[model samples]
Target: MAAALLGGGDYELQVSLSEALCRLTPRKDREQRTNQWFSSRDVSRAFCDIQDRDFEVDCRHFLNYVNRCHGDQRRVHTFPCLRAFLDSTELFPPKDEKLEKFWVDFNQTSECLSFFTDDPQVPSLT
Candidate 1:
């Protein structure tokens, strides 16, 4: 699956786990960030096992569905489909106000591709 995504050439959407988390977290909470929040292996397995052509379309639909929910910032984390691509931390529990900021920033960002800047050292999705 990684090969497919990498070979697709439109993989600009694929950002590393760390890169995604770093944008949602502040420097002080950096120590709490762990790569184990969500497993890439699980994502690869789930994505590969699915036999649907409209997965991306379904995802967009789900996003819109969740966007209208009350307390969507915390509610967004409970779904399994989005979990496949997103990496999150338990350090900031659902009750933590910071978690709201994290999800808000994540949603506002360009599909979590913050590393696509003028810098030459672009991070890879691992």
Candidate 2:
């Protein structure tokens, strides 16, 4: 799956993740405004790391970080699939008013991709 994404064979996942992050962490007018940051390099590193380590654990930790930042009102974003997984499993941390605002704003952003309907057929990393 990672290979397919990185190799350009899985553009849908790439697009979905990218759109999700942007929605979750829109850049502020000024720099150093938010705690969330992401890039292709970070995603690639995370993907490779997950391939070698415990994907569930890594994903949990990663999502926790993202949720924490969101709660803290930090301007950060993470992978959409991770967020979706967290939402589905109720794994997100206790809600905070500040984070709720971020979540709402994040959700308001345009959705550029849809993993829910794209039919990602990759094998589970576990």
Best by TM-score: 2
lDDT of candidates 1 onward, in order: 0.30, 0.34
Q: Superposing all C-alpha atoms, what RMSD in Å does each candidate have to the true structure?
A: 19.0, 14.3
- Colliding residue pairs in candidate 1: none
* Candidate 2: tens digits of C-alpha lDDT, residues 1-126: 222222322334434443444344434421221222333444433433332234334443434343343354433233433343433443333233323211211221334322222223444589
Give one digit per residue, the lDDT tens place, for model 1 in 41-89.
4332333332234433333232323233325332222221222222452
Model 2: lDDT equals 0.34
TM-score of each: 0.20, 0.23
Task: Please list the residue runs of candidate 2 whose C-alpha ends up more than 4 Å from where it truly belongs after superposition.
Answer: 1-51, 72-126
Worst 10 residues of 2 by lDDT: 100-109
How much RMSD separates candidate 2 from the native structure? 14.3
